[model samples]
Target chain A: AQRVTQPEKLLSVFKGAPVELKCNYSYSGSPELFWYVQYSRQRLQLLLRHISRESIKGFTADLNKGETSFHLKKPFAQEEDSAMYYCALSMIGDMRFGAGTRLTVKP
Target chain B: DAGVTQSPTHLIKTRGQQVTLRCSPISGHKSVSWYQQVLGQGPQFIFQYYEKEERGRGNFPDRFSARQFPNYSSELNVNALLLGDSALYLCASSSPGTGEKPQYFGPGTRLLVL
Candidate 1:
């Protein structure tokens, strides 16, 4: 079974400070990893996918196969960046999501 | 284009009752997936339907069932609802040939079971 793990339940960062949301997955086969964000009172949106390697909203994640981790990072954090982030892993036909991390970009 | 949309933004049901939630995928999207998100938890996959056929299903009870229509719209039916079933039901749509690569999620239907 593929499992997504997000070690941080809550993370707070000062404005203009760097932020990193750690994510780890356990899967024997190659899996597609993704990061999704849900803002307050808004629908969940795709932040980025490892395969695309596109940077969105100043956030970037690098898939490390050896470590089985895909950590989302941003050089500078803004208040609007605060939201609930979820790491998801898709393998074959099944998709699994992590517990989620509440990111708070404090002013 | 219109993103994925779900019906009955909010629903309340009691134990032993049955409820059905509807989802309309984005125009031209051919796959629909259902998920359950409890308070403070991430969404859990329930079912995935593509081209009117079930492509995948998560670890859920038989009480939870869903089907995609010819139009690619879908409905999720829950029988004998339990308190644990009270959660936000999310419907996601993926483009054709994408399988589950990247899914566009709807606002979600909030179901409350008593």
Candidate 2:
């Protein structure tokens, strides 16, 4: 079965520190990976997609096929970056999302 | 352009009761999908409808059904609800014929099953 795993349920980091939110997947075929973020009192929104290979809000994720991972990283964490992040895999007809990791950036 | 829209910001129902949730896709978006998001968890796929046809379905019971209308709006009907069925029902819209286009989500309808 296809599955997305975000092992860290909560990640706390001090402001200006580097942050990494790990995401791994198990799929038989090529998968489209995406990072979606939900801020407090806001609806879920797309952060970025591996296909685009573009950075959003100073955050970037690289899809590593060998490792089956697409880890989101930022050089410096910001207090505004704190939110619930979800890793998702899109297949032909269905999309599967990880349980999600809540990142809290403390100032 | 307006984003996707859903009706009934919140709802409360008893177990075994039935409920219907509605969604309107963004302008010119031909595909509408439904998902169930439990508190603190990622959204789970429920159904996907494109051009008035059922394109996909997730691992849900028969009590859950959905249909798309001519205008691309859709409705999800649930029968025999359970306490576990309480969740935020999210509706997303995307244009078809593209390879893995990003889905735009709406403000979900929060359901509480007693």
- Among the numbered candidates, top DockQ falls to 1
lDDT of 1 at B100: 62
Instruction: Give candidate 1 regions above 4 Å deviation.
Output: none
lDDT of 2 by residue, A1-107 (tens): 99999999999999999999999999999989999999999888999999999999999999999999999999999999999999999987789999999999999
The residue-by-residue lDDT of candidate 1 on B22-73, one tens digit each, is 9999999999999999998899999998999999999999999999999999
Candidate number of the best TM-score = 1
Compute the TM-score of each model's chain A versus the native chain A and list the values. 0.98, 0.99
lDDT agreement with native, every candidate = 0.94, 0.94
**Where does candidate 1 chain B have its weakest 10-residue lDDT segment?**
B94-103
Error of 2 at A29 (Å): 0.8
Task: For model 2, name the residue pairs that clash.
Answer: none
Residue lDDT tens for model 2, B45-87 = 9998888888889999999999999999999999999999999
